[model samples]
Target: MPLHPFLSKTKLYKFLKTICKPFHVVFKYTEFVAFIDENRNKGKINDYYNKSTAYKNRFQLHDKLLEELKNKPIFYYEFGVAGGDMIKKWSLTNKVETSRFVGFDSFEGLPESWENKKEGHFDQKGNFPDINDSRVSFVKGWFQDSVYKALLDSEFNEQCVYHLDADLFSSTLFVLFQIFPKLKTNDILIFDEFSSRDHEFEAFEIFKKCTNNKWQFEFIGAVNNYRQVAFMLK
Candidate 1:
């Protein structure tokens, strides 16, 4: 039996996007890489890769990614949930049973600069769009000063997944320290803008330095959007 015309096109496009988006990114990245090489662009292609959705979606594979962290009571705690886009998409794809996702932000805008890099998208504070998920909540505050002290109550300590997209060294370190006690060997941690930012990387390094190798860490899959890294905690 033939499907309705509207449903067929919708399904077809969904299938095509799932199959072709990664290829599109790789192809575009190859071209961008070639352009940089030919013009001696001095790593501008890196920035281009950071802005690609193909790369971002690769990091958002919640089904496989979250399944790897399924033993404990999981909580997807995100530092910055702009428009709740990633959370929304992840909820659609993942088979989460005991996981609750919490997104924290100034939502207003980024906090004052704690590092050398002076550019970020949240220059002015704004309100988040209405969230439809029962499991997701947006907390408004700066993560460094407020997130841990304000929100880390009895309920949040039971989380297993922490996505640190705080975009500042202080906030990243804050999450590491504040959340460290709650992290079990089965937990997973993700840094949404860590690879290019040396300061954020240093936070992870410092955390690792203090832990004496009790926690096992790995960079999962390929580099996504050039900067974000999904790390599986073992």
Candidate 2:
């Protein structure tokens, strides 16, 4: 009879080796040490942020920005308004009486596959968060279709804060290029998935190289193992 895949001689031998005397002991100890080290690192990060002016969460960061821009006529743009949760929060927490909140999303998920995620991964089909605030509005289409048109109609000639959460290289790049000319020193830019090497990170690198713009890393927030980075145009 043909050998079963799971019970093949090589597999059995490896299994036996794993469970053997010193090897098993060593493996368990190594795993335990790794677990402890990971927890220690996470704890350090949390403790440091807890004691610093640097925000420990995205909401806190937004709150700080709102405070700083209070009573000013600021323009805030949020890309990838998934479920509209953050936008709604911004609308409610906003202290700037004349500020505008613009959110852009395809409402149909990603335009293309990113890494292991296939295209249409986050499609919401135009469903957005319900906000009664008149200052809040949305551009419901892909970045390429909606950004320029929205900008043309908007009364946003002043510096603005850009929250990029699209999580795709193409979408992020398109938006960055479209808005590059309007960005000025001291303007803030937030990258929701900045750690994703092939997506947001790559897009930002390309934008920096192409524009020769200088940016200062200002803050970082970590939650549930996901990280967000903020930068200031300089």
Candidate 3:
């Protein structure tokens, strides 16, 4: 299906593309610089400049927030919960006594091909992590079906921390639109593929434009050489 008519021709679309162009250049330049720096030093690049650093920074930020909100109820959501590794870690490490952790995935994987990849490329054949934590639950289906059902059932109401790992334009956009209205200031959003121009990045661009700038987010950290990024809603 085609996008809404308003989505195709808008100033926001142009503006977002304009802003994003520089980042593409910067990423390429940084890669070149890192290669040279590593060769000059006669050593492998340090963890400080890699995905490990991003994960460390992202988790540290989440930890700080968890500490601050320890006494309050928090709804933590993990999209694209493949293998459930991160969500399981979060459930175990979270200090918030009233926090609820929810993981969403098709369990059958990519609804469609992404960036020259074939459809169902990440399929897990319904094999998801068996998280034993009582605070965690899993939604099994595509975002279009499961997410909309959750919304209609009023399963989401409180402020949330979102971990978006869905790596396709359609999947990300579908999830974003479903949850955008519920997002609020202070909520944290973590994107595992933020720099992918044709996927998460494009979804976010459309989302920002469609929302008419009603909300803003501040960058917190990035990992995997900026393949992942965390932001705080403001």
User: Which candidate comes out best when scored by lDDT?
Assistant: 3
**Which of candidates 1 and 3 is the stronger one according to TM-score?**
3
All candidates in order of TM-score, best leading: 3, 2, 1
lDDT of 3: 0.73
lDDT of 3 by residue, 127-171 (tens): 878887788888888888889777565445566788888988888
For residues 1-234, write the lDDT of model 2, one tens digit per residue: 665776664578577666686875666556544533444444212232243333236565556566666567778899999788777777677656788889999888887898788898888867876888888988888789889988878765656889998999899999999887677777878777765666786787789788765554444333323336556666
TM-score of every model? Answer: 0.63, 0.69, 0.70
Clashes of each: 2, 1, 1
Q: Model 2 Cα RMSD, Å?
A: 10.2
lDDT (0-100) at residue 165 of candidate 1? Answer: 73
Candidate 1 vs. true structure, TM-score: 0.63
lDDT of 2: 0.71
Ten consecutive residues with minimal summed lDDT in candidate 1?
39-48
Off by over 4 Å in 2: 1-56, 214-226
Which scores better on lDDT, 2 or 3?
Answer: 3
lDDT of 1 by residue, 1-234 (tens): 565687566678678678988887676556545533543322212333444456455444444465555454567777777677666655554446655777777776555564554445564356764767676677777776567664546364454667787777777887788877777765667776664344566687778888786687754532444355555677
